[model samples]
Target: MEPQKINKGDRNKIYFLVIVIAALIGTNAYLFFKDRQQSERFVTVSTEKDKLRLEVEKIEVELDKVNALNLDLNEKLVEEQKLARVKIEELKAALEKNQITQGELDKANTQINELKTFVKNYNDQIIQLQKDNIFLKNSRDSLQNTLRNISNKASNLENENANLNAKVKTAAALKLQSAEIIAFRTKSSGKKVEVTKSSTAEKLSVRFNVVPNQLAEKGHHNIYLRVFDPAGNLLADEGNHFEADGQDMQFSHSIFINYNNDDSTYVIDWANPKPFIKGIYTVILYADGNTMGKAQVELR
Candidate 1:
């Protein structure tokens, strides 16, 4: 009935084991807290991608405003719009794969910067255009006043018409070299042959040429086509809408041309929703809000 006494070495070993266990537990707790902090601070891929997407949407909205103004008569703004859209697509693809990296984020930001710069430049140009227009208007008024004083009203009106015509001529950014539309039959064999009768018409092949114009701001151009039947029904395909002079309008089809201020050819095939009728078909071509040309065909 005597209490057992522990050896000194055994007591020291026991103390050492207790200290080791306590140290291990503290280290593990510290590591767990540190990892939790890092996880809380981590940004997700979707967040970054959403930020990029918002930037793209911003750029597109600005570009749309310019387009609605119908003052972006060149391809530069359109090209910027295209580039922004391309970046959005890339971001979407990366987000789908969950592989969006910091580098992709940086690239998307770069595109945003470029698009913003473009928007600023476009706004500046628009302001300058407005200033020029005001100057022109004031000059016309002064000239009219002088003409009235001198009884040269007829000459004053002629001068005004001339000025308007000059603006119109300069506004014709792209000139037409050639344009044609040929009706074709799409056979059951998936072969095509030129057809004359509307009954045999499967689709209309539209072709046109952009003549070189050094004055035209060169890049990518969106060319629109409006096909009208005898009853004036618009034949539409993709790119069936456009904004012209602050008015929304519908177009039949559209194609893009990279006009390096050089002659280039483009074509688009249109298959109307309804069969062709035996009547006159009119096709008009427009580029950057300016009508390049028009032609008509008699379908018998």
Candidate 2:
């Protein structure tokens, strides 16, 4: 058998076939590598986006905790809590897109971390403020309690003083039961004769019985007598004015009676320098600065 001779046309056809096969392989390899690179980049973006979303969720939770504080006492923190929630919403919005850049991710991560720090600091501040409030409240309560105690003590002292004053007044009071007044003229024979004619009357006698009281002190007490005539003038024989219980009053006469916490009788005499003429005469007896008894004597 004889070897066949190679032609240029056949050789060119073989070279062209080799070039077409090589182009098909190169195109298939480029498509495969490009698809794999796209898948890997998508996975990275998804992972970063998920991470940012989770961070946002974390921030939301922290915001809820911060907002849980007492609003009345911590009203100043309301704005801070709102701003944190706003930041969380921004993060959520940023992650909502199907695409994310490296710079956006970095920014989100940093902001999330900063927000966490802010939340911690704000929470600590709120707690400290609340503690201060408690301290102030307790201090106010203590002050109020002290004032109340002082007021109560002062009231008790006043009550005690009032009781003491009442006791002193009771112990110092004197009572008189029976009172008698007689108008008569003394005879020249050194004897006493009762007379009802005021034109000839020469003397006036006053008598009273001191009531017994165990509470009153035993002492020589001065008794003042006020005698009023028909002209409404006090029959003052010695002094016209007498002081009783810080009041200056005009009295007719006075006598010292020795009291021993028992019933005692006393008689006092008053002399008229002039002729007495009256329709009715009133006699008021004063003991311990108070009017104790009174009596009337009638004369024609």
Candidate 3:
């Protein structure tokens, strides 16, 4: 059996329907594939965002560790830390978005790497500062020790000088060898006669010989005399005093003598204003602030 042929208009309509169906299928396929590509890109962006978040967290942990060290930071270092933290916060904010571009993700990654470098440099600076502090402490300790040693040496030298001055003062003092005392009276003819009786005595004479000393100062010497009666009463002049052995003492009289550093005999004559007593009279002599010698005479 043979099939009958269709008309040209019917064939053209069928062809038009087939072409429309093909266009619809092609459009649906393109739309479906485009949706799939968008979904994949979104997933990739999410992964990148997660990776960036992990990097930020890691850097934050590093920062926390460094801060825990409690190092002393300078103003410049503190500012650098602030800037790094701000950058990290910006990165975290960008990653929090549901959508992010490759460019933005790459920018975040680059900033994170910069932060790592900054952290490394900051740690290095802290290490250098610690070393410097240690060196300065050692130097200060050494300087203090040196100053203390110098002060000790100076104190020792001062003590030695004081001792030497004391020795020199002792060596320069003059000494007297012997002393004698005599009582005398002036007669009616004005002739002075030596008397043994205290009732007739009007004046007492004290004589002493100074031992020759080269260390003694030569020129003139002021000799102070302290006379005491047998009753232990000092015959002192009013307001007449002199310094002897680092103490002030009242003296009966003072006389000037020329000392030639040779053994020379000197006499001091003292008149008693009161009546002489029948007892011993004692005399002490001082020169150059020292006791030279003493003498006594018995009056009958």
**Residue 10 miss distance in model 1 (angstroms):** 99
**Ranking of candidates on TM-score, top first:** 3, 2, 1
**RMSD (CA, Å), each prediction:** 34.6, 8.3, 6.9
Model 3 CA deviation exceeding 4 Å by range: 1-141
Which residue segments of model 1 deviate by more than 4 Å? 1-172, 237-239
Residues 1-300, candidate 3: write the lDDT tens digits. 889899999999999999999999999999999999999998888888888799899888887877887877789988888888898898899889877789988888898888888888887887897787778889889999899999899998888888887677667776778888999988899988999998889999888898888888888989999989999999987899889999989999989999988878899999987888988899999888888879999999
lDDT of 2 at 158: 95
Q: Please count the clashing residue pairs in each candidate, in the order shown.
A: 0, 0, 0
Tens digit of per-residue lDDT, candidate 2, span 154-212: 99999999899777765667867787888878788989888898987888898788778
What TM-score fits each model? Answer: 0.42, 0.55, 0.59
Q: Best candidate per TM-score, number? A: 3
Model 2 worst lDDT window (10 residues): 66-75
Superposition error at 247 for model 3 (Å): 1.9
RMSD of 2: 8.3
Evaluate residue 266 in candidate 2 and report its C-alpha lDDT on the 0 to 100 scale.
Answer: 88
lDDT of each: 0.77, 0.82, 0.88
Residue 50 accuracy (lDDT) in model 1? 78
